[model samples]
Structures are given as C-alpha cells and as structure tokens.
Target: MKTKKILIVGTGETADLAYEYFTYDSEYEVCGFCVNRQYIKENQKCGLNITAIEDIEDKYDKEKYHLFVAIASSKLNYDRTKVYNELKNKGWKFASYISSKAFVWHNAQIGENCFILENNTIQPFTKVGNNVTMWSSNHLGHRSVIKDNCFITSHVVISGFCEIGENTFIGVNSTIADNIKIAKDNFIAMSAVVNKNTEENGLYTGNPAKKAGISAKEYFGVL
Candidate 1:
C-alpha cells in the first residue's frame, strides 16, 4: 500500500495524541500540523512544521494530504467540523483515529473524522456518526446511535438503544438511560442522569436530567 501523508489540524493535546496514534503504524506518514492563523504560536509542532490551514497546499499538495481536525469539546468540535467540511469540499480527505486500546465490536459503525480514544468500549451494533469524538474510558452500550458532530466526554455511560443527536455534548460521568432520545444540539451536563426524551436544542442536567435551558447555542454559539 502507498504511504499516506496526513496533516493534523490542531496543535493541542488532542492533536498530539492523534499524531502519536496515527504515526505508530506504517500505514500513515504524518506530514505536519495546520491550524487557524490566530492559534499559531510556534513555527513547528511535535517536530513537524506548523502551517496555516489556508496555506496547506502552498507547502504541501492538497491531494496528497489527509486532514484530521483534532479539536476536543463540543463547541470546538462543531467548529472543526465546519472547517473539515470546507476543506473536504475543496478536495481534502479526512482521517479518523481509532485507538489500538479501544474495544470496538465487529458490528459497530463509525463514521468519518471520528476519534475514539483509548479504553473506549463500543458495544455491538452501535452507530457513531461523522466528526464524533469519544473520549477515553466511555462505555457506548449496545445498539446506541450517536449522531453527527457529537462530543462525548470520558467516563460517559450511554445505555443500550439510546440515540444522541447532532451537535450534542454528553459531559463527563453522565449516564443516559436505555432507549432515551436526546435531541439535536442538546447539552447534558456532567454527572447528570438522563432518563427521558429531550426536546430539540435543549440543555439538560441533574439526576433524571431535566431541561436546564432552551439550547446550547445561547451559551456556546451557533454550530
């Protein structure tokens, strides 16, 4: 197989983790790092040159580089998704990272640009959509569906048959009850317990998680 050149589109902790994960195997050859102009602090990152995303092809061929947006957190994840989609439209291939330490079942489906961290347990028949981020040590129950651009923090327990919607964020140590449907753009705060169906764009929290606000956009800005 041909060696694939990859560009990690961040220089943060998550980007470093992704770099280490992708470069470990012979399949990928990491070319460099790319970030928005404002975030560029150093000329080089992790021993690779850091370039602005707009000048990616000026330094490297766009067709020859696979891009991975490595930003964590829901708001930033959504922002990164937008950037990835724009670059994808301009003909860049997106890369996903599935840690070697993660335990993913054979029947599970993971979409493009997803990052499944170490020790994650993705049970059978689970479906994770595009640009989703699953942090370390989360348990994704059997047949659960996590929709596009969702950010799942570490130690989350998503029960079987649960459906998490687009642009939502499941905070750390949260528990979603079996068969629950969390609607689009919702935010489930840390340590909350979700038992019932949530409305679109709702912000839920507490044990048996109740609607805390109308939507996350009020706090995080529009996705």
Candidate 2:
C-alpha cells in the first residue's frame, strides 16, 4: 500500500516526536514541517525543511498531503485548537494517530487530529474527541468520555464512567475516580486525585484535588 504524505504543523519538540512516530510506525510519510511565519526560528526541523503555515497549501497542496497539527496545549489549549480549526476550514484533513503499541479497545471511538501514544490503554466504550492528546502509559477507563481539545499526560488513570470536559489539561500521575465529571477548561495538576465533579475553569491540585487559589487565568492569561 502506498503511504499517504503528511505535513506536520509545528517546528517544536512535539513536531519532531510526531515526525519520528509517523515515519517509523504509521502508514504516513511526513514530508515537511510548518509553523506561522513569526514562529519560524530555524530553516530545518527534524531533518525536514520548515514551511510557513500561510504558504503550506501552495507548497504541499492540501489535496495531495494530509496535515497533523503537532502542537502541544498552549494558551489553555486554545492555541492548538485554533490552528486545527483554521487548517480544517481551509479544507485540510487532519491525521489521527493511534500508535500500534497503544491498546485501544474495539468499541472505543476516537476523533480526528488526536494523538494517542504508546502504552496507552483506551478501554471499551470510551469516546475520545477531536484534537485530544494522550501521552504514553495512561489508562482511559471504559465508558469514559474525553472531550475535544483535552491533553492527558502520562501515568494518568481515568476510571470508568468519567467525563473529562473539553480543553481540560490533566497532568501526570493524576487519578480520576469513577463517575467523576471534570468540567471544561479545568487544569488538573500532577499527582491530583479527583473524587467528585469539578467546576468549569477550576484549577485543581494536591492529592485529593482541591481547587487551587491559582485560577486558569494565571495559566492562560484568560478565563
């Protein structure tokens, strides 16, 4: 089978990692890197030439090459989400990557522009939304719903029947108990344990995951 050519949008570490993973493990061939002209600091990244995002369609031809926005959560996850939406509006198709080493149940559903890394287990009946990122070694329990534009770091455990809201960032080593509903735009700090429903735009920290005085505004400069 002929591998489809893909252009990853970003020139940072995440883009480099995406290039390596797509090159070796997936049926996609990464041909180049891209970022906004203002963000381009180098001519080359991961051994590939970086193209200005404004000129991406002219150079790569959206019909011929798919795109994967390899940008991490920035500005409360709005940065990556905005880029994804813009490229999508321009008629570019985003690639959804599920590493072969990841264990995703047959009944699980994943949306476009998602990146599921190695050692991740997405149990049956789970629903992962678009532009989501699941780092390595995480366990997504059965019947859980991870909304769009969320980022889940490594070693996080989400028990069954949980609902992680859109644009939420769950840090490493966090444990979300079953039936918990994490509200939108909340930040779950490392080593936190969520046992109950969260408020929207809440900043949670510590073992029992109490609301921190630091608001989401502190992290994103906006609510």
Best prediction by lDDT: 2
**Per-residue error (Å), model 1, residue 2:** 9.6
What tens-digit string does per-residue lDDT give for candidate 1 at 1-223? 4378888988998899888888883366888999988889999987889999878878887777888888777462577778778887888888778987899999999988888889999999999998899989999999999999999999999999999998898889999999999888888889999989989878888997888745677777774
Name model 1 segments beyond 4 Å from true. 74-76
User: TM-score of the candidate numbered 2?
Assistant: 0.95
Candidate 2's residue-wise lDDT over 1-223, tens digit each?
Answer: 3378899998878988898888888999888899999998989876888999999877887778989999998877888999999999989988888999999999999999999999999999999999999999999999999999999999999999999999999999999999999999999999999998999989999878899877774767754
- C-alpha root-mean-square deviation, each candidate: 2.1, 1.4
Model 2 per-residue lDDT at 140: 95
Candidate lDDT values, in order: 0.86, 0.91
Judge candidate 2 at residue 65 and give its lDDT: 90
* Candidate 2 off by > 4 Å: none
Positional deviation of residue 98's Cα in model 2 after best superposition, in angstroms: 0.9
On a 0 to 1 TM-score scale, where does candidate 1 land against the true structure? Answer: 0.91
